[model samples]
Target chain A: MTFKKFWVMAYRDLLRNRRRTVITFVAIALGLTLVIFMNGLITGMLDGMLRDTIRLDTGHIQIRAESYEVVKTSLLWRDLIDNADELAARAAAMPEVAAVSPILWASGVLGTASESTSVRVSGIDPASALFDPIREGLRAGEFLSGNGRGQILIGQRLADELGVGVGDRINLAVGNPDGVPQEGQFTIVGLINTGFPGIDNANVFLSLAQAQSITGSGNRASTVRIMLHDINDTDKVVAALQTPGLTVMGWRQLNEFIMTTMETGTAVYSILYAIIFLVVAVIIANTLLMAVFERTREIGILAALGMKGRQIMTMFLFEATILGLIGSLFGIILGAIVVYYFSINGIYFGDLGDVAGSLAFGTSLYTTLVPANLFLMAFWMLVVIVTVSLYPAWYAARLEPIEALHAL
Target chain B: MAAIELEHATKIYTIGEVETRALDGVSLTIEEGEFTALVGPSGSGKTTMLQLMGCLDKPNSGTVKINGQDVTRLNANQRADLRREKIGFIFQFFALVPVLSAYENVELPLLLNGVGAKERKERATALLEAVGLADRMDHRPDQMSGGEQQRVAIARALAPRPLLVLADEPTANLDTANGEQAMDIMARLNKETGTAFIFATHDQRVVAYAQRIVKMRDGRLVDGNANGSAK
Candidate 1:
């Protein structure tokens, strides 16, 4: 028979039992919507965490001494970049570079008269745009000067825990490059609240010059963090800043743990998506099988009218395709709307954010809509729907003409 | 050449441990343009005989030919092709595809035969008109009366202009008036198209319209020659 006639017959057959058809449509739509929404939420959470980490901790790229070990928080002059100013100047000249700052990292203890805690101290160029989040997060007091002495900024959460506020005199001790502890009394110049618990709970900041002088590392900083105008330009800037003695690292390499976690999470979600698709497929297959049972005599008539078994199979598949196409279309629209809404107005998790503090998860989670993922999901749903329908179609096709005609 | 020839055809049915011979050494010949009836009571295998003649089933032993081509060795697809090209069928149920309208039902066989669009439309329209269903062409099977649906079935059977039409019962569900009306339309169409028809029925009114009668008892022909026709 002509393909057009097959489609007409299939469509009309679906309309014959409108309620069942509609139910099947809803099943497929809901199944796809659930998956799409889940993917959107997960995408948003991962992307958000990565963005926050890049903003508050790592920049788009970091240039450090070839032998520098971040885990060790090393203060040896050999482990620090001595030409930080020159590297920062070269990177600042690049149009792709949004901001460049020389930062010296040290492991230190900050002690008030009543309380003490180990903290990661970041010595930063106070005027650099890379510190914009910290400046914007200044909850109290004033920001430090580029040439400030014996001054530091502590997180609001840390300040709350220590019962110390701005202008509170605190004793800070750090290991100098010579391996002896150097102690200095510093006044807390500002209180910052960046909303990222990883940063706000355990970090203190000071001017680059003060940190360098206290550490006895002459004119040396730990690393030059560079933020790009577009993160996609990280590789290009990294290539531009390729110096023989310094190692340039892009965001992907710097955030290897998060990338690995995302990959593992995707593998787990794939199993979930397959289960969802399989359930939808089973619903489709069951509906078509019931249709075959109900239309046995009609199938006999078609067979007697010279329609081959394969043609019969094709007709039922057409029915499935019609339902799938319309259902998936509706599903994609509904899913996009939901994802878009969540992307704008995020879902609040409150203290749940601190559970993943090390990953820089924020206080609220937003969804991200990836159009290609939506289409890919729809495509796979269609395939699964059609594939699962083969059994019912085959059953209908294999019905003996005389025997089917005998069926009531 | 004969339109159909069945020689020593035997079909057996095996239900669990029980075996029954549905058709036993039934040999018959039907010439082109002949209207014949295979009349028998229930369990006489009249329907099975018609099924074999229509290529809807294969004989266990013996050869059945359609348009002088041996179809016993043909595969399922080849048999379907042959049936599409050469045979048509009508059932007691007024077996119109319920989802399709009367016009599409009539056009179905033609579509299967891959008839061109213009000719398919013309022939389907003309056949529906011939069957007196031209005005009801847009109606689905449920919308049409039994007689009307049977007429649509008749139109569908002849759409491909097959060499023969094999009908099983055909009028068992119709009222007396509708039954006679359906038979009258079939008789007229049979004469107009010059297509041979073989109907299996116990209805006297249906049998009265046939030109030849082949009566069956159990699985064997009770009268007529080896050709199973009283000429």
Candidate 2:
């Protein structure tokens, strides 16, 4: 009951200065809104990057020869998986596996008579569902066939850069498994525009059989890339595919750089959030201090009426709690609306796509709504507001009744 | 037993390098049920004397007793507890909490004392009716006239059933009629409740309502009977 009266007093006191109260509320709301929006945008951008990398490049998990080194593009027979088809079939039999394909990776150069550029060549089973995104992205020509000879599928960006089109012939030179340079003339049977600059800028795909024949690595593959029904099932599938001479890796291991960057980004954004909260906290503290100054005589009356110092402080803290709760509620609503809009129609980064091509970031970035983050932000905002209000509350509580009553 | 006792209490105020004796070796006693006034000129220490007696401040040299318990040695919180349980105050400014209605202002002390809800409402309503503010119970201080606010303050002071009520120039801001109306209400309530009243004022009309008047000059009691007419 005493608490009820204190709450009543606090609530009415806020109403006494409606304009100031509204202004303080706006400060807290805007501060929290900005934090939530930034959190959503950053989380979306990073998660989108990771998703794109996994979809277009890493898959959920990969099984490769134990001696294989991806950076070296080692085409040595000893470094390649000899029973690649058998391993792929084994993985495809698992219920957790969404798609399984034996892929051959090689470093090569594509020439169009006027220009030549380095590219990563992917030899894939065109029938595998794991390449569905690439198949769906076929811009001008049909997708590759399993038995097509001397045919390749290149990103529209790569074709545009090389001044080539579908059905155009391009010369590809690669090192065979015997360390001999092999050259072949292949037709760009299809062009793909996946909207991912990393893939569009430097990747070319061909049938796995033809790739093995050209590289003189018969029945061999660089790795068996497996896509899971759910990314969480990567560990289960990997455990089921643990063979003696193979190394199984999950997407997290393949994309360790992105994961590390995300962790570091979280720490940096936490400091940014702290700075934002501090700014809001100072505004709240200043507002309560002004209220304390204005209510000096009233405080004296309350003290003379037998309210202890701590009780007086509790009243002010209650005021802050009310302000914080309502303000943050509005902030969460506004922030969620903004984030949802951006999540649907992403924010466009036209040139940044090309700049961040190596990171597999798309041209447009979307937001992800994490309910926990929104609530956490609101909770911390309330905590900061109440914590900072302590100084003004303490000042009011320590006032001497006689001196305060004498104040004008 | 005396409602309040001050024995050779002295209070000094210091500012910068200067010192002023606000109260000097003053001793006084007021028994329960006495209506008294401390009359003096400006800076003559009437407010200081009332502050010491009210437990708002501790004297620099002497002891103040409220309900025969030594209050000068008590800490701030202890003094607040004593004030809440044993005393009440009315200010010259009609110090009703501006945000609260008259009824709420009167009920604030009772709420602080943790009185039950039903009893709190009954006592607050009865007191407001007694002060002739039964219709003005819903009016905030800003919405009411000075006289009405003062009457509200009076009701609030007596709401706690305190041993004494201290009023400092209770009518300083009211007109002649409002002042007399406030004084009549306070006099009637004092007689009816049998609660001690100590007011620090220079108004002759207000002093006339006091059953015993103690005069002060330069922080010293001028009356030969330091105990006042209560003796």
Candidate 3:
């Protein structure tokens, strides 16, 4: 028989049990919707975390001394990058390089009149692009403006613990970059709150010149941070900046814990989605199997009327294809709507108590719909639906006409 | 050449170590354009004989032929092709595809034969009108009465104009009036189309309409002679 006849026959068979077909269709659509929606939310969350981490903590790439075993802010000048200024200037001249920041760091104690706490003081250039996020996050006083003025920026969390506000005097003590212990009293110029409590609780920022003066490390910083026009260019830029005595690292390696967590989470999410898909496939298979069994007599009539086994099988497969197409179309549309809504109006996790701080990213979780993912999912579900239908189709095709005609 | 010839045909049904013969070494020949009826009570193998003649079953140790071509040696698909090209079938319950209209059901055989749309339409329409159901062309089986559905089945059986048509208890489900009406249509179709028909039935009214009657009892033909005149 022609394919058109087969289609008409298969469609009529589907209409025979309209309620069952509708229920199975809804199962497939809802399964696919959950996959799409969950994948979008997780992708958006991971991408947002990576972007914010690169923005607030690690740049696209960083260069440090080869001898530096651990990344800690210590005032010991032995492991400092002595020619950081020259290196930063050369890197800044590269076309692919966006901005470079030279940072001097010291493990220190920030002391108020009645309290003191251990802290890591990061020294930065106020006007550089690297400090733009923090500059925007200045909640109280102004950021450090010049090279010589004694000023410091403390996180709002740290300031709260120290019971100090803007313009208050705080004393800092650290081992000098020359290997001698030194102390400095500076005015707290600004308070910073970047929403990430991990950074806010223990971080203090000062101008590079003032940090070097207090640490007694002349013309040297601990690291030179590089931001590129695109983070995907990390490998190329890292290769270009491969100096003999300097170690270059990308954000992925620097934030290995976060990256590993994201990967594991994604894998787990996919397995869960696959389980749900499998359940939907089972439902479809069961429905088709029941249909074949119920229509044994009809199949016998067709076979006795001269339909080949292949033709009978084709008819059943065509029915499954139609069902899959309808379910997947609805799935894509509904999933896209939900994803788009979440993308615009993010889900807030702030009420869950420093959720961003724990995750080391923003608190609001948005969803992003990747069109390729939607298409791939639709294709996969269709393949699965048709593949699972083969068993029932084959069963129908192999049925003996005489026996089937006598079946109840 | 005979339209159908069954020589020493045997069919056995087995259920859990119990074997019973349904057709036992029965030999019969049906010529072209013959209106024959295989009449018997239950367990008389009338239905089994019709099934064998329709290419629906293989005889255990005997040969069956249609149009001078041996069908006993053909495999399943080959037999199905032969059935498609050379044989038609009608069932007791008027097994019309419940989803299809009367027209499409009649058009089914021609479609299977790869007939073009224009010819298919003309042939199906003529056959439905011949069966006196032209006005009910678009109605599904449920929308029609038992007699009308059976007439559609008759039109479908004759649509391909096969060398032979096998119908098993074709009017068993119809009332007396509908049964007589169906018999009248089949008899007229046989006369007009010159297509041979062999039906297995116990209904006396149906047996009376057949031009030839062969009676069987307990898996064996009791009367080998054909009464060519209607009773």
Candidate 4:
């Protein structure tokens, strides 16, 4: 039979059983929705993490001391980026490279006249490019004095825990210029909240020179930090710059659990895809099988009228494809609505503190949109519907005209 | 030339432990342009003989031929082609596809044979008009009366312009008036186009329209008369 006639017969068959066709679509829609929702949830989690991580700590990507990879301890002669000043200039000159800052980061102890706390002090350039979330977190006073500072910019959580406000003097204990433990005093200049629970409670920022002085490293930074025009290509920059003794880490590698979870969620989404498609295939197959049985006599009459076996097969397959198309469309629409609603009005648990703490950075999560999921679900079911109709089409084509005509 | 030929044809059916022979040692030949009737009560093998002659079934023991081709050995595909090219069927109960209109039902045979749309429409329109159903061309089978539906069936049977038409109980479901009208149409078509027809029926009125009549009983042809006009 011609393509036109095949389609005509298929459409007629589907219209004859409109209720069954509608139900088949609903099944596809539900399966596709699950796929879209799961996809959104997985993507949303990682995107949220990367946003916060860049805001408070690593600005897209960061350069740390070569030794920082293996031993994250106080620096005592790591493979230094030789001539850090020249390399900083080279990085800053590249069009894709943005501002460059040399920071002296060290883990140390802070004490006041009354109390003390463990602190991670970052020696910063204090004036880098447009709206760094880490910099935005600073709430009071300036980061560094114009003539350099004998001052500290404290995080709000640390200030709250320590009962210190701006203008309070604090003594920072560090290794002195002779590599011996030494003490220095500075006035609190600013207080900030970065929103990263870990950093907000612990970070302190100082001028690069002051930080260098406290760490007893003369005119040398712990590491030179290069900010890029596009953070997405941090790995490419690392590949282009990884020397023999130094290692590079992307923001993703910094937190193993987040990357691993992203992978796990993706893998889980694929399994859900399999289950959803399998359901569509089975439903379509079962429906077509019954449909063929019901139309046996009709098929016989058509055949006796000289309709070819292949035409019969084509008709049934066309019906199956139409079923898939309608189902997938409805599914994508419904699924998108559900995904959108959930993404906008996220589920929250105020008591999720301990639970979130136990999770990777432990917080209750929300879903975001991932377009590929809906498309993927629709494509998956299209294949399923087409494939599932095969045996039934062939079965209808194989019916003996005489026997089927005499069938009651 | 004979339009249908059956030589020692037999059909065996497996019914549990019992084997029922639907056709036993049947042999007959129908000449072109002859309106032949195979008349018998139910289960007397008239329908079986009609099916074999129409190329719808293959015999186990012997040969069956239509329009000089030995169709018993043809595969299902070849058999369908044979039916398309040279044969048409008028069924007992007006087995019109419920979904299609009267015109589409008649258009079906031509469509399957790869006829183009304009020609198919023209042919179907002409045939339905010949069958006195031009005004009801768009009416579906379920929407039409039994006689109107049977007229549509006649138009379908003639659409392909086959030399032979095999009808199994063509008037069995119709009342006498509709049945007689349907027979008159077939007789007129047979006279006009010289299209041979082989009908299997218990209806004596159905037998009246045939030019030759064959009597069947107990899976065998017992007697026959040429120029069928007998009771």
Candidate 5:
């Protein structure tokens, strides 16, 4: 039969039972829509978390000593980056490098009149772009103006625990030049809230020079955090900055847990899509089977008219293709609308509170509509729908002309 | 050459252990352009003979031939190809594809034969006009009366200009007037196109219109001009 004739016949057969066809199409459309929306939401959440983490904590790449250990017990200056000014200038000179900030990290305790808490003291250049989050998050007072004037910036959670606010005096104790414990009195100049539970509860910022002075490490830092023009250039920049005694790490390598979770979430989402499409397949298969039974006499008539078995099968498959195309078209439109709305407004999860924690860093969830994923899902749905219709098509093809004509 | 020849054809229907012979050692030959009717009571095997002749069913222990070619050895697809090119069928209930218009139903066989668009259009239009459905060409089966639907089926059967048409109870559902009208169209088309037609039916009205009658009783041909004289 001519291709046009086959399609015409297939379309008319679907119209024989309009209600069932419409219902099956709706099932496929709604299933695809759910898949698209879920993928968009999860993708947006991961993107947001990665961007926030890169911007706030890990930069795009960090260069540290080869033997650097995160859990350092002693205040040894041997593992610190030497000639930090020269290395920072070298990193900043690369075309792909955006900004690099040298930081001296020390384990210290902050004591006030009421409470004392052990904190991770991050000494930063308050003027550099690396401190942009702290600058943006200033709740009260002013940020540190110069290198070492006895000024400090504390997170809101830490301030709350210490019962101190801006302008309150907090005593910081660390190792001095003699490798002996020494105390330095500093006034809290700023109280900042980054909203990330992990950062807000543990980090206290000071100037790099002041931290070096307090830890007796003159002109040295633990690491030089390098930001790139684009996060995608992380590996290239890391390869370029591979020095003799320095270990360069990308943000993904530093945050292994987040990357693992993102991969797991993606795999789980794919399985979810498979299950949803499987349900769609069952619905389409059942509808076509019922159609085959209802059209037994018609199939017999076609057979008697000298239609081949493969032609009969092709007719039914064509019906499924039409239904799948229409349904997936509508599904993409619907999913785009929903995802666009959520992308603009975001879903508020005030009840989630700290559930955002370090991963999401916020209570409101947004969605991103990835067009390629939507297109792929629609294509897969079409393939699956056509495949699922094969069983019923085969049944129709195998119908005996004489027996089917005699079917009551 | 005969349009169709069935030699010692036998068909048995087995229902779990009870076997009944539907056609028993029946031999028949239908010439081209002959308007023949196979007339009998129920279970007389007239329909089975028609099915065998139409290449729709295979005989158990006999050879069936179409236009001097033995078709008993033809596979299902080859048989279907032969049918498409050499035979047509009109069912009892007018079995029109209900979704298709009268024109499309007539054009279906031509389409199946891979006829080109221009020739297919010309042939289908001419046949629909011949069947006197030129004005009702755009109407579907549900929109047409019983006689009109049967007339469309007649045009469809003749679209490919096959050598033979097997119509099983072609007018069983129509009233007397409609039945006579349908039979008149078939007879006229047979005479005009020289396409042989065989009718399997118990309707006397249909039998009276045939140029020759073959009668069967209890799965065997008993008497008729095609065999011998009336028993």
Candidate 6:
């Protein structure tokens, strides 16, 4: 039979069972909507965290000491990018390279005449830093701008422990860039609380000139933080720049565990998504099968009336495909509805005390729309529905007309 | 030329573990432009004989020829092609697809033969008109009377221009008056168009329209050593 004719027959058959087809469509739509909406939430939360982390802590890429590259936790810092000023200028001139800031960073003790706390302080050129003016975190006195004399910025949590505020005399003690224990006193300039316990409690800010003065170093910083338009192109830019004693570390290397966790979570999400989709597939399959069985005599008549077995199969397949199409279309709409609802009024995870602590990122959770996920769910569900449709088609085609007619 | 010719035709059905003979070594030939009837009591293989000629069932052993094509030796695809190209069937229940309109019912066989939409429409409209259903072309089977549905079935049987039409008690569902009207229509079509008809029926009233009647008993030809004809 011609395609037009076959499709008409198939369409007619489908129209006869309007209610059942609608139910099947709704089933697939609901399943796909769940995955799309949930995936959107995770994507949103992850994007928020990435922006916070990237905007403040990791500047897309960090050019560090080779020693820090090998044993990242090692305190053996490097002040040894031989041509730091020249290389930073060269990289900054590139279009893709957004910013290059030299950061004198180390972990040490923050103290005063009153109290003390552990702190992670970075001494950076305030004007050159891309974002998160470490100065913002110093919720206290001024940033001791351009003063060759020492200055300090402390975290809010660290400030509470130290019993101090801006203009208070605080002694900053750190092992010098050369491993020599160094001590200096600076007026507290700021106190910061960024909602991240890691940053809010332990971070401090200072000027590179002041850090160098306190540590007795000249024209040297611990790391050159490189920000780029494309984070994944670290290798291309890193290879382009030849610097002595400098090691290039992209965000992937800097946050290896987090990225890996993202990958594993994605894989798990796919499996779960597939399971839910299969449930909908079963729903569709069961609906089509029951339909085939119920229309056995009708199918038999069609088959006996010079309708090819293949055409019969195509007829049912067309029916299933139509059901899937309607389902997927509704799924996109339903997914949009749920996405809009959750986007405006976020889902709450109330009082997640210990649970918050366990999360690798932070406590805030929100769904987001990921196109890959939507496409994946949509394509996979369609395939499942169509694949499930085949068995019913084959079974329907196999039904003997005489027996099927006799069935009634 | 003959319409349907069968040589040594036999049919066996498996009922559980037992094989029962529905038609045992029966051979019959129906001629073109003739109104022939196979009359027998229930379970006497009258319907089986009609189904065989209609290509709705395959015989256990036989050379069944329709317009001289050896249909018994053909495959499933070929059988469907043969049925589409040459054979037409009318069921006892009128067998109008309930979802379709009167016009679509007649258009089915043409559709099977892959007739173009315009031509199919024109031809089906003409056929429905011939069956006196022109005004009721859009009416569904349930909306039409029993006589109207049967007439639509008659129009469908002629849609493909098949040389032969096999009807299994085509009037069984109609009342006496409708049945008479249906028989007149079938007889008129047979005479005017010269399309052969093979009817299997137990109704004695149906036998009156037939020019030749063959009687069967116990699945065997009961000719009694003569060419039996109740003309």
Top DockQ prediction, candidate number: 2
Best candidate (score: TM-score): 1
The model with the greater lDDT, 2 or 4, is 2
User: Model 1, range A23-125, lDDT digits (tens) per residue?
Assistant: 9999999999988999999899789878988898889999988898645678877889988999999999999999999999899999988899999989998
Query: Comparing to the true complex, what docking class would candidate 2 get?
Result: high
- Candidate 6 structure, TM-score to reference: 0.84
Q: How would you encode candidate 3's per-residue C-alpha lDDT over A1-408 as one tens digit per residue? A: 488988998889899999999998898898889889988999888887777778888888888888765456655656789999998998999999999989888888999889999988888998899888888778899898878368999998889888999999999988886667789999999998876665689989989999988888887998899889988889999989999888988888888878999999989988988887898899989999999999999888888888888989999999999889999999998888888899989887775535335444355688988989888888888888999999999999999989889998
In candidate 1 the C-alpha lDDT for residue B78 amounts to 91
Task: Please identify which of the two predictions, 2 or 3, would achieve the higher TM-score against the true structure.
Answer: 2
Where does model 6 exceed 4 Å of error? Answer: A61-79, A82-100, A107-121, A125-193, A197-207, A210-217, A226-257, A351-364, A370-376, B224-231
lDDT by residue for model 1 (B108-154), tens: 88888889989999999999999898899999999999999999999
By lDDT, is 1 or 5 better? 1
What are the per-candidate TM-scores when only chain A is compared?
Answer: 0.91, 0.89, 0.85, 0.74, 0.87, 0.81
lDDT of 6: 0.76
Q: Which regions in candidate 2 have their CA more than 4 angstroms from the true location?
A: A65-79, A90-97, A107-119, A135-145, A151-204, A229-248, A350-362
Off by over 4 Å in 1: A69-72, A108-119, A135-148, A154-173, A178-197, A354-362
- Native-vs-model 1 lDDT? 0.90
From the highest TM-score down, the ranking of the candidates is 1, 2, 5, 3, 6, 4
lDDT of 5 by residue, A41-94 (tens): 999989888788778888888888888874452456667889777888889999
Could you give the interface RMSD of candidate 1 in angstroms?
1.4
Question: Against the unseen true structure, what C-alpha lDDT does each candidate score?
Answer: 0.90, 0.90, 0.87, 0.78, 0.86, 0.76
lDDT of 3 at A135: 82
Q: Score the docking of each candidate (DockQ).
A: 0.72, 0.82, 0.56, 0.56, 0.62, 0.42
**TM per candidate:** 0.92, 0.90, 0.84, 0.82, 0.89, 0.84
For candidate 3, give the lDDT of residue A210: 90
Better of 1 and 4 by DockQ: 1
